[model samples]
Target: MEGFEIRLTSSKKGKGLFATKKYDQGDVILEEDPLVSCQFAWNAAYRYLACDYCMRQMHYPPETTSIMLLVRILAYIQQSSDPSAAIAKVKQFCHRTENEDAELVHKLLGEQFTHQMNTLREMTSHVVSGDEVQEFLTPEGFCTLMALVGTNGQGIGTSPLAMWVNSVLEITMSDDERQQLDLFIDKLYQYVEEESGSFLNTEGSGLFQLQSSCNHSCAPNAESTFPYGNHRVQLKALKPIMPGEEICISYLDECTLQRSRHSRQKELAQNYLFVCWCERCSSQASEPDCTSEEEMSDEDIDADD
Candidate 1:
């Protein structure tokens, strides 16, 4: 963490994280394990939990040890209010425990709770969901969604879970957190391919990691060529960035229109706690004519004349 820095840099709008050192094309940034890696399971006492989309089961064992771990993960996900806050809240509603408390759980799990939580949040948020899946999985769109649930995009929007969760759970965003998230989320649209094209996993891998210093963007300055074996992420320069420039990657797929992407970013910001000022957000503010109706009407008027 010394040679590398996750330092904030100046931007016209606000602040963004950048690399203070010169990072080579395939340099390693940050790597860690997932906090909660339970397989998809249903009717395993961890019931009512399933993949956000597809209704696929998220496997989990029901041994005493596994139950303890699952309880702790549910607590962490609930208390921290990360992107999985909605799902966490639902679990809490169903789980009414007499002896369990947040303080006791943290004491038992120790740093694993914090470390894995942050790392899981980062890896899931930044590395898993984008073109990385296209590099690794077939039936590419499913890979993207799978990678998405594996990250922050999980169990929220675009799922039947939202209807049930929304009815029972209330997730509120503070104004400041919402603003910061707004800037961070708007950029994911520029990097990921939209058609859900196929990604070939040259090697079988489940995990990937990136340097924490890399900034978040919809249109990122760098792209990752993901490797197999836990899907380790390899960074590549997408453009000719100057030395000391902050390298960034999109946390979401790029296969969406600017309006759709921006709207999602706004929602993510309110949910995840960061404002997005990525290049796309910047340029889109100054550019014109993203409206489809306007272009269609102009064509009709021209034909009449």
Candidate 2:
């Protein structure tokens, strides 16, 4: 909100962020904390642990993914006396299409919800007087949460000692006495990683009310970064911008910039449910014609984490 303002005009791309004043390259536009954040589930195959809240990488590996975070959010909503307000906020996000390739996204969301419910039931089955499950846990609510995450979640990167220590301790220590020793090793590793300057942790995903308003542009003028160690993220200017210019950011990886117009548009459409009409896309289209079937190199495809 420092250098930008939200414009909700119908002419614009739904809700979008716009510059309030001129900004030079590298100027910090806005620094904001997330409305909600969850640590990513660690994948044994990938051997990376990201923060549940900010998606920052930890010392060891991630054990729970976004689905775990979604379960946490749902539990919070169920415990609330009135969850209507929270549901209303989630409903604001755009939902994925049912026709998308193999219905993968839809299927995954459904599966994760079912898994969470079953896990909760098993955990509490032995309890004599467990709380009754909330009635609001429905397919509609699940889809709404998924849509909110798919559309608005921002990937943050940072190094936090507590996240690293807790993750490492959880895996290494089973008793209180051993936990103390594990903590020491955790602190030592953290210091080593920091001193080596080789740490690039993907802490977790977060939802931001202000940053989410910025739409995607292949040639974006603004870039989001997590400079602060906590959940705070900053949106910085990538180039000079005049007042009233739409402050855009790239939803895909930076490598997408090197891809052809056809490739970029296809990726955007499939993943984001939108076609690119930005200046870069337009300019590329006007250039030399290329086959739509041009194969993307293996390097162009980002490895799934």
Candidate 3:
């Protein structure tokens, strides 16, 4: 907040954070701990030594990773396209931004109907008292919470082993000492893998107040990192940025960024509901519109989140 201000974009794309001073590549523009954070059940494995990064990254595992839209989240329970009328049979719930009737979840979490039933029953059962009950606790509340986390929760990747390696490399040491240490590290990992067979630090996601203000761009000038290897995030400049420039981050991952204009546009629209107007997308205006080489899935979005 010191060197940046939240205000409306000149392009009228709603509010965004703009630089109050210049920033060089690799310079930290901002650092923030989450306003509120949560651990997913999968993150329970974080107690293990081999962090989540070491485990083969799962691509598009629908059961654990896909994000469902509020509208579609409701439809799974509503069992029909008329979500508003459908929810009236259960309880009053929040309306959708894109449209009340949209079935966007068909593309994201199409097979989560049973998951919703179980989650709603389990989640609502915990309401100990009416005084403590929040409005977001009905069948619709399940949809609201899923959509909220999907849209806003930022993923946290942490690794203690990586920290040890970085610290060892930072210290001055003889070449022979370095070789010995490298061998020791390799053997240590091998030993751990053999013993644990399967181990990982679960990646958790969180919501950050200030960091969330940074808008999306196909070519983001600044990016978020977790060099300290925890939930805390530091916004670092990817390229030099001058005063008055808007700091942005990509909502998609490295693989997704290389997608066609149409493919990129489709994901952004589905996730964020706005077509990206970044320079990279605009420059490729003439590219043929089609689906991506690999269908964009919740797994891809999860990687970025």
Candidate 4:
């Protein structure tokens, strides 16, 4: 949290985060930890040992850590972290059942999907309350969890190794030195790929308190990034944000952002379960609605003739 004194304002979607002080472009607005987080299933399969309770990976610099902090530790951690707190802060997040992700629903309904879910419940039953675990086992509860994560999980992507490589390439170097360094890096990557085939962008997602409160806008003022190369998310202003302006983030990727409003709405509806009324969409409100921008272009050409 920086200059922005916050207001939890209400909207049809739920709540929105507003800034009480202005932020310059590239200024960091906030940094926060997640309530819970997990790496991509495929990423986890890459043999990165992480804490069972917190999801802190082991590949970083040497520090004492144990993956043995199981579901029991989850309950203990939550309880001990606050003790007197009645409701978990994560409960403030939107968890509408209708927002259950399509892919998540398909995966959960799969025959093999419930094996880990069932096993985890069985193993943690003694420590976690039966009622709590039982609710999560139900379809409605499952949907709620999926919806919460789907809607609020701010994506995190950072690689310290990749950053170091970029830093080395940026430094001034003689041609021969640069050539030798490039050759060494090529050989290093060859060895790495031999062991781990096709390493791609590290996709890490987390449920953040402040980030979850920020609403989506097709045109956004702020962005969430993992600059420190970990789960600690830093919200940076994409433009000069005014004192009273509400902070918004883009849910759609670059290609989707360029599409017709109708297409954008479809994407958001499918993924986020809401109609957008952001400024970008509002300006195009009077335009003839079509599925794709190309269709609109065709119609306009016909009209011009």
TM-score of each: 0.37, 0.66, 0.66, 0.68
Q: List, residue by residue over 1-305, the lDDT tens digit for candidate 1.
A: 43334444675322334555665555554443433333223324434354322223222222133322333343444455364553433232211122222222333335464453344344433433433222222233222223222222111112232233344334567878766655654443222224222321121112222233355677776765432222234456666555567777765545432344445364335333356666677667654433467455654774584
lDDT of model number 1: 0.40
Per residue, candidate 3 scores C-alpha lDDT tens digits across 143-235 of 544555455556655656666777888888899999999999889878867875543433555556678778889999999876777668898
Q: Which residue ranges in model 3 land beyond 4 Å of their true spot?
A: 10-12, 45-108, 111-122, 125-133, 138-142, 168-202, 290-305
Best by TM-score: 4
Report the C-alpha lDDT of model 2 over 1-305, residue by residue, as the tens digit: 46678877355367788998999999999888776776555433345554445555453223244555555456545566766766555445444443431243444444464565455434433321113223323444344455556566776656666555556556754588786877777678788678744454555667776888888898899999776555688899999988989899998776666778776786776556677789888877775434434433432453331
Runs of candidate 1 with Cα error greater than 4 angstroms are: 1-3, 9-17, 24-32, 35-213, 224-226, 231-236, 257-275, 288-290, 293-305
- Give each model's whole-structure lDDT: 0.40, 0.63, 0.61, 0.64
- Decoy 4 TM-score against native: 0.68
* Angstrom error at residue 108, model 4: 8.2
Q: How many residue pairs clash in each candidate?
A: 33, 24, 4, 0
Angstrom error of the Cα, residue 278, model 3: value is 0.6
For candidate 2, the C-alpha RMSD (Å) to the true structure equals: 10.5
True lDDT of residue 11, candidate 1: 54
